[model samples]
Target chain A: MSWSKAMPANPVVAVAGATGAVGQEFMQVLHDLDFPASEIRALASARSAGKKIEFAGCGQVPAGELIVQEMTPESFKGVDIALFSCGAGISKEMREAVVAAGAVMIDNSSAFRMDEDVPLVVPEVNPDDVSWHSGVIANPNCSTIQMVVALKPLYDIAPIKRVVVSTYQAASGGGAPAMEELYSQTKDFLNGEELKVEVFQHRIAFNCIPHIDVFMDDDSTKEEWKMVVETKKIMGDESIAVAATCVRVPVLRCHAESVNVEFSGEVSVEAAREAYETAEGITVMDDCSSNTYPMPGLLAGTNDTFVGRLRKDPTVEHGLALWVVADQIRKGAALNAVQIAQLLLP
Target chain B: MSWSKAMPANPVVAVAGATGAVGQEFMQVLHDLDFPASEIRALASARSAGKKIEFAGCGQVPAGELIVQEMTPESFKGVDIALFSCGAGISKEMREAVVAAGAVMIDNSSAFRMDEDVPLVVPEVNPDDVSWHSGVIANPNCSTIQMVVALKPLYDIAPIKRVVVSTYQAASGGGAPAMEELYSQTKDFLNGEELKVEVFQHRIAFNCIPHIDVFMDDDSTKEEWKMVVETKKIMGDESIAVAATCVRVPVLRCHAESVNVEFSGEVSVEAAREAYETAEGITVMDDCSSNTYPMPGLLAGTNDTFVGRLRKDPTVEHGLALWVVADQIRKGAALNAVQIAQLLLP
Candidate 1:
């Protein structure tokens, strides 16, 4: 069936792993965007199956509640669109069942992202890639998603030669438990009590940990590996060289990145600023004299990618350096997934 | 009088601006390093003159209490060494007095760092640069000091062609008031009160601000400009290109840097690690598999410059990326001054 053809007036949506941090955001985003769905189902593991989540609906959608159900192969029987935020292992196990049930699965996990048939889509950067997906569409990593969104406009002006990114990632990227860990550990530190390290490998209260995810044989963290590969896939440019240093900071929500981009041709700062001002889903917050730049603390819970500190890089022949920030759960994962679901609507 | 001449067993020392943050650290460093001084005088602004500071002296020095004196030209009457951390204006006004009094002024302010006659010294990286000092020696910027110390060993292996650095600086780099502001603002944030941002341009309790120092004409902050020029002067290499993004995080002490270095010749990870391990003031804490990396929280109050997360940068032909952390108060400022004072002894 062609997604472009009108099949139903309103689609039936299923939110897998609905109790998760990103899963909860998925529900909020769908409501905020006023997605026309006749029915919405919240599915999770058996542990959270009976938990109730209230949705303060927006516009025409009436306020309602959902009782989470234990997901099974038969759960997607009449679902037209499924948004999955479970771990990669669960996504791998449940993807085939969702596809067989005739639902277009937009997976936030990395299980099928690198698969030859799967299309990794960032709506603002590569929306066209969504059209070629066979059964599943994948979301890029949170860090890569924001960087690509900010870089897309500039890359369109002049082809990018290479990128060097250093990330100041927040705790929310690891999920709700990680945010709780940061809060508790900080409280303990303030009270002169011993800090317990459970979610992260080290004490993250006022410290910067260079390790994120697990380490690869070559010493690069898996998070850094995802940025290098996912950036190439989402930007649809295999030849663009990328180097990443992903650091975890003691922040709660928004993830910040210092991105240095080198172009094959000359791209002036004025041209770059104009390109960002006209780009979709981007907010330019630069003005060094007035000290108006993006910080994770101020921009948390916002949907737009905030870009600031734009300047010329004197090291390269033609280069520009910028700071980018966005709420990792919203624009990076949930909103992008919902945008893809809106595209698949009849 | 030559500093090399052993005319006296103990030299008269003076601590300028002895009540501020770096000034307090100056006293601690002098005591901890056991600088042999016949007498110690604490000097500060007129408001802080009467305060008493206790020093827990080390080695041959005996513990004693010093009464802070209102600083004047006569404060350096018989002082063989003066550690100045007052602002640039004070340093500029007092330099002639200290020099005429036959005292070498180790100035910590930015007043004389770029002056051609004054040698900008990081003892481990450029000890030879100290030989030609004309009565005044300048300390490099805190952020620049740590990066160069970490890069010095690797640069010696093969000269670094270009450096791209992004810093996670601590609040202590701003001064004692900034540190107090961070603590008070954080307490207010946790208690659901309004955050008062006075010391920094933005809220730095749980955020990162890219603007440090003043903005230059080309939109780069003076802190970033300092890193570029100071790295060249400290390393004695004008051909090396540098780009930096100096950010202030909520950390209380040590500064962390994510540095990517490109070299002119081939350098392997093992070779780079060996150079750091063999360097005078560097500690290699890189064992990614076991999560043994240097973090600012764990390494505060230490003199060594910690280096970790060492790996190859696949974006450059001959390159390496590493993380460096150093106590901004100790090695970054006070300790470097004390080390230079030791070099002046007979």
Candidate 2:
């Protein structure tokens, strides 16, 4: 049940797509957990090989390049856990290969999220579901992960029939290219030059982009679709009716969502506040009397999903409105994957 | 029935409380509108006297001291048009006095908005309401003014029933001292120094403050109250049920709102789009295909209320979600007041 090379017994960890943003974050998180690892392998496409990354603030020897070695049954040798953070295509191609090689795969992609056997884990919301993963565990989308982390506790108190959320997502969720585009577009606009947008479909400087991913036949993007489906899976209710309008803001790191949840019965504001206060992995910063609520700048570099602006929705009989913010790179991707690895650690 | 004497001759214009943020904006805007003024009287409290301000854009005239004069009946003697940008107390103190002095007072404070006598005007939404003002025109609250401007066109095409809005208000809505506090607190947070909060009840640096103004018995703040009442007054419809959550974000100038509106009849998203396209004082920017949407930064320094993220609220039968952004200092306060003055000009 372990990937220990020597009988002395220390875990061997493998980081798939280790050079990407969240992938790099996963490495740092693992070292921060002081994961009892005898060895660590930073794997990526051959294109990113020999790229050295320094793991500061966490235990690290110099990071080695991931060779262009094809992921196969033999690739998971001596590895107890494989944290997959590359794109969905790579995860889909190699998920079974790594798992068949006898290592547990904690994937930070959307490939196997709907797979009934592959548990979609947000740890705080559904750690018990992790036991059901066939071989690979799926990480929920960044927006979905933060929201359900806050919504789960509330949903348990009263059955949530509907959720309407509008997300002010960050550039990090679009990967390093959109991050570079944000920086470049901002610099261009600041310099009085025309903004050039490549990664984004439009100019992202000083503007909110409503389209996060390509639209489907229903006009909902893939990102919004993830929120709708993933919430159903994580909350263990397919009838949970969720609708989302995903937007990308100029913010650099944290993603924010303005969420309104309607329940089956009357959920008073005070009761909801207390529920969030006691909720794990969720921080209730709701203090409107003194003007303190959750925001992206405040949630940056934090693992806890900050939830605030909690108030009763006067529109519906049993409705609550809140603003939730979390670091997409951390809790949404890296830290969640690392948590799964820690859970599976011998 | 014009206020300008130029036609007419020359209109004597006075800017009450002409030293504050919107007051200064009043003077600039008066000149920008080519206000037919033989004399411009700059009035403020005794505290802000002997301050010479040159209205360069207003024909490069050498400005005199900001007179330390009480807003009494006699002081408003020759003012054919008196634009009042003073506090609510000042408006209450001088409204009758200015009326007796034979000057039409356009007060930009909350003292007279709900009053049946004073007609609240957004011009874009209810310009005709201005004709009935009994020597004292009421200016709607900043947030309310912008919301109604965007909602007016939509309401005409489809009768609106309920409006649920959560505002991402700017620091400028609270005036200059609050802006100073925002900068100071931000620097303090960055320097790891003690955060100083004076105007706002809480530290607004890297945070969202949900409470604006005093709280009402209903647990909503005075701000939320003003939006509800003023929208009714300006739109001339008390039947529209409205609820608002006013939030102050760290943003300096523009205020953004996430609005969910429902109508009595089924209105297609395309119909709402058409209504916005033809609406005056509004710029429709709802192209979600290319990531184009309205944002506070782009709306700043402009008078138009920019709206985007136009989509059918999948949860409701005739509901649509919209994001509205406008420069609070300009369209929400200064420019709006100035535009009202423009209507009175020759």
Candidate 3:
């Protein structure tokens, strides 16, 4: 079921859900990466149709405004790559049409992530997973994408046995409206007005919510479950056990994770640092003397997955602990999707 | 040597570092708990000597302003219990004077915590640890205090083999000035002004700092080290291993922890919930169906250690995960100290 036709030298790319947060990031990342797109079309729901979105041009596309189009089956007629950031329902609704139109959909939704024929890919970790994709290439969860980017180098060093992670996620992971809620709620909180929480389960201003996404039947949030199952799928290691507690903090953009990894054999802090230093798409920001580490507030628009606070965990026989941070919208979402699109090039 | 004389029914209480954050909380908690203090002396350094602090009526002490006194060696002459929240250096300096004058020093600093003679006590977890204290009984670190409270009830159900905890600590844990910094910096950040970070190493307005205290030689922060050592000492189980990554979050008060505990035996989520329901000084707030879990923003000023998000971690055998939150100043500091004082009563 792999792609039968070779992708053109310059693909006609469609940015689905263009008016949304990650959709905008998708356009920016394509320009930043200098992706060779012959024509770029902005597609969204009927409500957002005709909205003008400014685009910094990339490849053959001119630098100007892109008029939003209502996404429909005919929208993908000449599209070589459809970058989907719409919800899962919309993605599932348009999947067959997208495939039949001879366009490869790199989906940001969770719809086909666990499907047997669909490829769940993090370009830095599993770019080869893109080769076998049957029309739809699933982008891993934002949290899982950054984690696996940081974990791949380590996994190459030694087989990881288990991971215990607790995330300090950002509002950006919830999309544009959630970020707006954080901004307005913060203003209200500071002004002594009662905070109105509409986008989150509770007021996200100056607070930490232990729940992210919907709660699963097993009491783990859907986001937490995604990290567990996605890591196994993307890393191509079913034996690795992950216990995740995903929490949302008030930070507007970058998501940080405190990860403790236990390997099948000894992997020293020095070895891990060296692995990260040479690893693709990973920047090491660990230095205790200078008070330097990757902070979420200051790392909003970065592409690399930043790793820091590397130390040994004496509690386990073969363990190392580290802190990871990356822009949830950039490396965690948009940049990773763009990288996957890069792998689809001829 | 343990206290030689029996404590009077109404002890003369001294609030050292009276002008500091935890010192103020100590006073509030004393009144809140209706502690039987015959006379409450507000003691501070020479700079704050003449300042007055308002005290609510409690026991023999009347509701009025108590003039602060300069803390000299003679300050503990008639004091029966000296609740010290001053820095570790000052606590060490005043330890001998308070103990020589026959007053038990219940210190909130890290001064004598690891000292063999000083018994680190969390009253609910190990009230008996106070029995053999040689003059000074140490209150555990704020992060360690809440975690052990949550762990105690679970441990009672089964022996915990290991614990991996990541803390979302509040600005209040840094003292009064830190809370002030969070308030001002957040305002400054919202107003588009450069954040002034004085109390913390970096901007903590909407960021998470992985380093809490000074970094140890092994690269783990001192705050993380305290959680590891203090938990073993307070739990009276040197066999229990702990790995902690402590981070400072933007919340004004109340520290929240994501704890993953692996027990030596099977402990179901139902069994763990039952243990927490009957556990003293703990409140279980877990209900995924109703979106009910303990949140740091809504749970300020609470004395109980709030436990929620209870679930099974299939990653390991006999594993259970939970989220714990407590007012860092109350149960983590002042209230816990007062509870220890209650243990010292005749």
TM-score of each candidate's B chain against the true B chain: 0.97, 0.93, 0.99
lDDT of 3 at A92: 96
Q: Which sections of candidate 3 miss by over 4 Å?
A: none
Better of 2 and 3 by lDDT: 3
Error of 3 at B287 (Å): 0.3
CAPRI band of model 3?
A: high
Q: What is the interface RMSD of candidate 2, in Å?
A: 3.8
Q: A194-263 in candidate 2: lDDT tens per residue?
A: 8877887777655555677777655567898899999999888988877687867666778888788889
Which clashing pairs does model 2 show?
B5-B8, B5-B9, B6-B9
Write model 3 residue lDDT over A1-346, tens digit each, in one string: 7779789989999999999999999999999999999999999999999999999999999889999999999999999999999999999999999999999999999999999899999988988989898899999999999999988898898999999999999999899999999989989999999889899999899999999999998999999999999999999999999999999999999999999999998899999998988899999999999999999999988999999998999999999999999999998888999999999999
TM-score of 1: 0.98
Q: What would the DockQ be for model 1?
A: 0.84
TM-scores of the candidates are: 0.98, 0.85, 0.99
Better of 1 and 2 by DockQ: 1
Q: What DockQ does candidate 2 score?
A: 0.26
lDDT of 2 by residue, B136-171 (tens): 787788899889988988889878888878777778
- Candidates, DockQ: 0.84, 0.26, 0.90
Best by DockQ: 3
